[model samples]
Every structure is written in C-alpha cells, then in structure tokens.
Target: MSEPAVSVARYLATTTAEGPGLRTAIWVQGCSIRCAGCFNPHLFPTEGGVRWSPADLAARVLAEPSTGLTLLGGEPFEQAEALAEVARQVRAGGRSVLTFSGFTHAALRRAAAAGRPGVAGLLAATDLLIAGPFRRDRLDHERPWVGSTNQEFVVLDDRFPDLADWRPGALDRVQVDVDRAGTVSVNGWLDTDRLDALLADL
Candidate 1:
C-alpha cells in the first residue's frame, strides 16, 4: 500500500533551538487537540500545508547534515504512521528522532493498546517524546524545550543517554531567521513579554 502524504507546515534544515543538538525540524500541519494558548495556532487547520510522501519527507530530512530530527506540531501523532516511517528511516541512517505532542503519554498508551498501529509505530520510532498539551496557565520557566509544567519528557530509548542527567533550569534558546524575501520565522520557547519585546524590535 502507498504511504499517506504528510502535510508539512514548515521545514528547517538545521536548528539548535528545537532539540538537544543541531537538528532538522518538520512542523506538521493539522491538530486535533487545539489547546488554548497554543503557539502555532496557524497550524491548526489541515488544509494549509504542502504534502509529501513519507519516503520523500525522510529523504529531505536525511539530506541535511543535522545530528537528529525534531518533529513538531500540529501534532506528530495525528499523522503518526507516515511520520513513524520517516523517523524509522532517520534512525536507520544513524540519527535520533524527537517528537512533540499534545496528548499525554497515558492517553497515547491507551490508543496504542486499542490497536492504533500508527501511534504504536510512532512511539516505537521516537527516541525522545515531549508529551502533553500546552497549558498557558502553567508556563514552564525551568525546562529546556517544553512550554508548560504539565508536559512530561520521556526518553524512550538509549539514544539520548545523557538526557537522564538533564536537569531543570536549563535556559531555553530561540532562533529568528529571515529568508531572502524578508520573511521572518521564529522558533523555540520564550515568555510572552520577552517575545513581544523581541518582535517589537524586529
């Protein structure tokens, strides 16, 4: 059977702000759990992004010289099967995969137990998973990548051994890039006040 097309909202070749090291990032399109105060509200609709087959997406990511791949919203698990294939291929090529999701780990486990193959596949392929919804009221100031204190960081396998030693209070880094046409794109975690200040000066 042919693989389903992956709706890609954004693709960055290399960025340190997304994960543990310089990594290729793919922001998927469409989100079922539209959390209040979500950062990428524009990505909530499924119809906006360009679609690519899993093989093609994996190839594009592998061509990059980054150390790993980071999968971000709309929600990786929503398009789990295709993204799982991409993650498997990336790992086969000797790179790690980090995935973010709005669903809690327990909920994901329940889905998997109910025979959701895609969810199982994606979970198996992911090396690190930042799970849980974005809670605006519970902003996380101490963690490295997560936005809320409710999110759980799960190290799925041995890929990121050093992650176990990772502690809170690590500073979050943001990246601002301007394309040739002067389109500015920003990623990473930042508080509302600081982000407003940064964007105001831009």
Candidate 2:
C-alpha cells in the first residue's frame, strides 16, 4: 500500500519559534474555513502547492535536528491522513508533534467520533493541538503560541509537559526566515501594531 500525498505550501526544516524547542514546520496548502483575518491568505487556494508523499516528507522533517514537528496551515486537518502518517513517522523517531488547526477541539472530537477518515489517527499522533478559528476581534498579542484568544492549547499527550508553564513575551518570540527563493516569512504570535512595525522595517 502507498502512503497518501500531502499538499505542501511551505516548510521550514528547523525553527525555534513554532513551538517549545527547535522544530520542523510544515504548512499545508488549503483551508476551507477562510477566517476573516487570516495572516496567511495566500494559502487559501486549494491548489498550487507542491505535493509530497508521506514517506518523503517524514524523511525531510527527520533529516534535521529538531526536537519535534509543528503542523501549520492552511489547516492540518484538511489533509488528515497524510499528516497523520507524517506525524506517526516523526513520533516513531521519538519526537513529539504539535499541530495548529482552524477547527475547534470539540468539533474535531465529534468528527473523530463520527468516524471521519484520518481524524482519529491524526489526533492520536499529535501531542499538542492549538485549535480554533482565528478571530480578528479576539486577536491575542500576549499569547505566545496562538493567534487569537479563542484558540485553546489542548495537550493530547504528556510529551510537552513544559508547555503548561511556558510563556513567551514580545522579545524573542517571533522568528523571521528567508528561504533560498528569497521569500520572507514570519511565525509566532505578535501584537498587530508591533507586527506592522516589524514588517515596515523589513
């Protein structure tokens, strides 16, 4: 049997800002939620991202010296099966998995209970899940790991025990990365005004 293919918009082999430690971040390509104030609007389109098999993606993520894996959007649950496989492989290598989703945990629980394909597997493979739609009105600048106040950090496993007390302030919270193609990207939570200033300086 062959592994499912994942539509990948972008990926960073290593980054400290995505989670507790150095982590590999994989941003999937499509999102149906289309929240009003999405930071990565470019990823809304359901097409145009490069495709990678689960095995290949797992190898790429594990190739680097990362403490864990961070799954970002367009929406990780949108391609649950592929991401599940990737997470499985990463965890098998003794690394934890963190995932961001536009769907709430309750909704995901219902989906999993209803037997949605890949939902249970993905949740099972994840250690921590940041779940909720990004609400512009409820944007939270103080939270280090989430975009909005409504988002909840649901720890599915005990792998990331430190997150219970981890709190990152403005300094050293955001990470800026420029790929070989000269595409500059930012990750982590920041105040809207501060984010504007940071982008203006760039």
Candidate 3:
C-alpha cells in the first residue's frame, strides 16, 4: 500500500512564534470548519498544497533544528492519521508536539471514543492542544497564541514541564519572512489594526 500523504500548505523550519519553544510549524491544507475572519482562508480548500508521504514528512520535520513541532491548519484534525505519524516520529526524537484545531476538545474526545482512525493517536502524540473555532467577536487580547477567548489550551503531558502552570501573560510574537523571490509570508497572532500597519510599513 502507498504511504499516507499529508497536504501541507506551509512549513516553517524553526520559529519561536508558533509554540512554547523554537519549533517547526506545519500548516496542513483543508479545513472543514472554515471560521469567519480566519487568518488563512487560502488554506481552507482541500485541494492544492504539496503532498508528502508520512515518513518523508516526518523525516523533513525531524531534520529541522527545533525543540518542538506545531501543527497548524487548515485544521490539523482534518488530516489526523498522517500527521499523527508525523507527530509521533517527532516526539520519538525527543521533541514536543503542539496542535491547533477548530474542533472542540469534547468533540475530539467523542470521536476518539468512537474509534476514529487517527483522532486518538493524534491526541496522544500531542503535548499541548489548543482547541475551539475562532470567534471574531470574541477577540482575545489577553492570550498569547490564541485569537479568541473561547479557545482552550490543554496540556496533555509532563513533557512541557515549564507549562504546567502556564498562563496567558506571555506576549504573542508575529514573524514576517521575505524569501529571495520577494514573496512575503506572515505567521503567528496579530490583531487586524496592528497587522495592517505592520504590513503597510513593510
């Protein structure tokens, strides 16, 4: 059988913006619950994006010099199986996995209980999970990584020892990357007004 493929929208080798430590961030393509005013509407479509076999993807992510791996979206849960393998391999290499999802933790738990293929595996591989859909109206200025207050940050294991009592006091960081081709990309959390101003200044 052919190895499972993950539709990867974007990949950042190392960054401090996505999670607790310098991490490799993978943004998978396709989101079932496309929330209003989402940061990456371009990633909502299931089609497009570079496809990589689970083993290959895991190898690439592991090659990066980072302390952790962060799974962003187009909804990481949408491609749970392949990504679970990826996360598993990363974790085996002594790295942590942080996953962001539009689905509620309760919903995921139910799915896992129902014996969903990779839901339980993915959850198992994750050290930290940020769950819930984005609510534009519920803008969360206090939290560091999440856009809204409805999102819950759950620490799954003792891997993230420093985060045992983690709060939302830490300031969020956004990064802008300009490749040699002059194409620009932005990641991390930033409010509209400031983001607009920053992009305009760029």
Backbone clashes per model, in order?
A: 0, 0, 0
Residue by residue across 1-202, what tens digits does model 3's lDDT show? Answer: 7767899999999988887778999999999898999999999999999999888888998899898899999999989989999999989989999999999999999999998879999999999999999999999988778999999998887877744334654678899999999998999999999999999999
Q: What tens digits encode model 1's per-residue C-alpha lDDT throughout 1-202?
A: 8667789999999998887778999999999899998989999998899999999899999999998999998998999988899999999998989999999999999999998869999999998889999999999988888899999998898867644434753558899999899999999889889999999999
* Residue 202 alpha-carbon offset, candidate 1, angstroms: 1.9
Please say which candidate is ahead in TM-score: 2 or 3. Answer: 3
What does the lDDT come to for candidate 3? 0.90
Higher-ranked by lDDT: 1 or 2: 1
Cα TM-score per model: 0.96, 0.92, 0.96
* Local distance difference test values of all predictions, in order: 0.90, 0.87, 0.90
The RMSD (Cα, Å) of candidate 2 is 2.0
Candidate 1 regions exceeding 4 Å error are 163-165
lDDT of 2: 0.87
